[model samples]
Target chain A: MNSSFRVTALLLCMGPLVSVLAEPVPDLTATLKAAFTDKRQATLDRLDQDETQKLCTQLRDQVPTSELSQKITRMNLATVKPPADGKYLGDWKAGEVVASTGTGLQSSDDPAKPNGGNCYACHELAPTEMAYGTLGPSLKHYGKLRGQDPAVLAYAWSMVYNSNSYAPCSNMPRFGHRGILTEQQMKDVMAYLFDAASPVNQ
Target chain B: MSVQDRYISLVAACTLLGASLSLPAEQTSEEAIAEYHAMFGDENPAELWQLRGEELWKTPRGSRQVSLEACDLGKGPGVIAGAYAELPRWFEDTGKVQDLESRLVTCMTNLQGLPESEVLAVKFGDGEQKSELEAITAYVAAASRGSRITIPLDHAAEKAAYALGESVFFYRAGPHDFACATCHSESGKRIRLQTLPQLTTSEGAQAAYTRWPAYRVSQGELRTMEWRLQDCLRQQRLPQLTYGSDVAIGLTMYLARNANGGEMAAPSIKR
Candidate 1:
């Protein structure tokens, strides 16, 4: 048999094995899109990535590129809209309820009802409340420490409004950016952190 | 001499009290959590579901009016021992890697002649929809209590499932851009007081996987693995995961395989 013919037979024998090995791996984006479905309040559109989301995913929560981080922060900051009335504080008593209630954005939850900030799920607000989470820093004396300074008030409002504006990949949710909370809800939570008589200060 | 003796006795008593006072007032979280588990050992609320399952296993009440006596769980027909430990295996008949719930649903329709839609309709147990599947799953898992986890990954499909699961675990996309790995891949990370298991590690995977199909104190129900996975996805703010889907089984395969050699400890009680 000719050398060229022998080589041709060898290639034919390896074709199936090579093809099997070369089969493209399933794309993560495509797999997730296929696996999840729109049910109740959770729509299929959620699977679609925004620019900020894409960057955060690519970096895996680490701020890898300074230029990208600045761009992300700038883009997210532009999305934050301050209260029209220039009010950053609301009834702290009402705020406590908003902070404590941990039900919102879930498919099982009723869509008609307003969303909750669920701050207590990640922060210690009241010094007396024995049961509190440690995912975020303790705000036990936030009001006493900051003392209603205008700049401090604005900073807190901005943080709660859209945390990503400051920290590109912060674990804190963009309550206002994602429409997770209303302006009144954000102001109320602000009062909970800034009211002198609030249990968080006491 | 009497005064000196009394004074010395008083000093000794004070020292003893001081030493005792220096000891911790309460148990550490780890110790307390361990004690919580130990308190419910072999007599957890999960046992009640297991009993109900055993009764259902023998009783015949389906569309075909037959029990699941002829069903095969990787093991031979009607065999319950050590069957769950080797689950999420590739079933030749189904030509798919099925987890416990998926395999159970298959048996319900194929062997008992029940409609797949009917079985899937009431997957979770609620006020008026008490899940028979949950009870059956608890019973099957309890049977393999001490058996070592040995999820098979020999087949090409099984390998594919594991790969898909691994990708799903780390695949970050959503409003929050959080993946399963975001909360689970790190050690000593937590949401609140509740501890998050680092599933990428063998120890974490083993600890977390062995405790599933557990009786949740908060829910007051015996939740199957499928229920647990669905809730996790919900908290992630992602769209609802279709129950008994390939992705769900794939994630299970990845976690179960990572937990190889760990003893099965399902039907456990969890806070």
Candidate 2:
């Protein structure tokens, strides 16, 4: 008797709302949610979006609002942090190793291991580092061209710290923002660029 | 065990077949370049990268909190547009013909006061600094948008880079005993749905070289030029390549020159 009473109550509640929701597309959130099986470091929360991410998705990389873009840049710029010691540019030799290796990250990666830079995968840094990608510019002899300009130094640092801070929808990852690189690592990469004795200059 | 053996046999067969085949007698390097140029009618995805890259160019970064507005790019400090077209050109101050990624490293270290090694330590798609390299490259390439793909071969460095690139391209190693020629030597070879362009031919070189920093729909991440090379290296299973290594640059010089005049359309989106 109770079961039948409950059924009737449920039917009554749904009957009116059915018509109201008839024009709307059926929600598939439940189906998608049910299919999700998060494993090891990979969680479902990656699907969640903040305001800027949502806007980018809506615009599909064609965000028309210059005001919105500038707003995003300014907003992200405020989030960046400077090194504690105020030192930049570390050892370039270590950086070359870092740039070459593509280890760490992913669920299989050991959290204890340091991450790699994988520079050859995109930008051409050292002319000798063949098998480099052409997606970005060739970085061979980068130091020779720039020659320790103060302004150049700041821009490169900011780009690594938080790429989005520079460009709202930049493809580059936000290293400092995401905590991917330590302050020391950023400095080492800097040395790879500016050091006169580095292979980049050679 | 037999399955593994079969894979070995298949590889062996492929090697034999590749060796046996050559470019069609009538197909000239010029024809190959023309074939690549034909694809330019479609939109150049590099345009998008340029926009994002330009924004990143002068944006402030790091703990010091500054922008790259004054960052020098080859001709002078803070100039970005068309800088890419001439680069891998000679630089007198440091006395080298550095590529873009290396140049960004210099600016980041000196201007922003970041350790060069840490940034160098990062790999493509691995960390934030590497990502900046991508954005900057896109921005820089965009400055040379619609410009010709002329990797100046006049410099001794350029010539040396070309020789190194050629040597690297054919250098064979790894568990599978593969070389770049394995997949890239022919006009019609493919791994699956993707057609492998013959790197030996100018058309293939241009089509492949001029379309990087590509956005991959399947992976949903922007692939940098370095990442592309690294992926090839990874699949090859040799020792991991170092960033800014001479071998990589030589290969780049070789390929870029082969694709010269094809035009750049980077920061391209790919399916």
Best by lDDT: 1
DockQ each candidate and list the results: 0.23, 0.01
Name the TM-score of candidate 1: 0.80
- Return the DockQ of model 1: 0.23
The worst-scoring run of ten residues by lDDT in candidate 2 chain A lies at: A16-25
List native contact recovery per candidate, as a fraction of 1.
Answer: 0.44, 0.00
- For all candidates in order, the CA lDDT equals 0.76, 0.58
**A64-145 in candidate 1: lDDT tens per residue?**
3567768988998999898989999998998998888777877777889888887876788888765566666788899898
Candidate 1, residue B4: Cα displacement in angstroms equals 67
Give candidate 2 regions above 4 Å deviation. A1-202, B1-52, B60-66, B126-130
TM-score of chain B of each: 0.85, 0.74
Residue A77 of model 1, lDDT score? 91
Per-residue lDDT over B1-271 for candidate 2, one digit per residue giving the tens place of the 0 to 100 score:
4534543443343334323222222233334334433543343333444555666666777656677777777768888766665556556666665667767777777777767766566445432333656767777766666767766577666676665566456543322223575567545543322456777667788788787666543343456666677567655434344455555555666667777777777666554
The alpha-carbon deviation from the true structure for residue B218 of candidate 2, after best TM-score superposition, in angstroms, is 1.8
Candidate 1 lDDT by residue in tens digits, B1-271: 4544543443344334334432332333344346545644444666667877887787786778888877799998989898888878999999999998999998998888888888888788864577889989999999999999996578999888887777677665555566787677556665545667777767888889998898765455789889888888888778898788888998898888888778998987665
> CA shift at A41, candidate 2, in angstroms?
23
| C-alpha lDDT of residue A165 in model 2 | 77
True contacts kept of 2: 0.00
